[model samples]
Target: MARIFTVDEARSLMPAVLRHADDFVAVRADLAELTHDLRHEGESPLGGLAEAKGLEARMDETLSWFDDQGIEIKGVAPLLVDFPALMEGVAVRLCWLEGETALGWYHRADLGFPGRRPLP
Candidate 1:
């Protein structure tokens, strides 16, 4: 069974989530640049294959951290995390996108991001 988070519980986790999100974004960008360098220039001053592998490992670890917390990872480029919860007995996801400052939105389990609405 998945862990269900209450609004306050989800909100309390924001600090750690934000930190992980920042780490993910930075590592992703570095990996992209290294990939581009290797593709176009045939080598990257960024340590080539070794550095790229390290970045990949770091990214995986960050993602695993979220998964271990029972938070769902919906997107990577613009990091999106969803907390499973029940609202008035209806299954829903408490949605938090990359740029949002707080976890203040949710969507029905079947609706996804397009159906996101403010948490009442």
Candidate 2:
């Protein structure tokens, strides 16, 4: 079932989301640092590139975290994207967990794009 959130209910999840985002940001930063070092250190650091899937798994953890909290990622359609400030191909959206209001917003996945929208 879809977890439609009221504005307030959705806002409550911000702390959790922010915390998870912080974790993700940290991992991403570490990866970036490693990538930089690889430029001087050579391709040896690129070994176990598959293990870097940890980052993707962590992201899924965030989504699953939301699912456990009762929120659902709206499918890639029927989006409530009515905004003047939206960048090309995306408009701010309201997403939430079950029995909650819209908690925050996310852009469709684009590799390494940091753009995100907190509940308005």
The most accurate candidate by TM-score is: 1
TM-score of each: 0.97, 0.45
Global lDDT scores for all candidate models: 0.95, 0.47
Worst 10 residues of 2 by lDDT: 76-85
Distance from true position, residue 37, model 1, in Å? 0.7
Tens digits of per-residue lDDT for model 1, 18-109: 99999999999999999999999998888789899999999999999999999999999899999999999999999999988889999999
Q: Give stretches of model 2 more than 4 Å off.
A: 35-51, 70-92, 95-120
Cα lDDT tens digits, model 2, 8-69, are 65566667655654565566565555556656675545343544556557656755665676
109: Cα error in model 1, Å: 0.4
Count of backbone clashes for each model? 0, 10
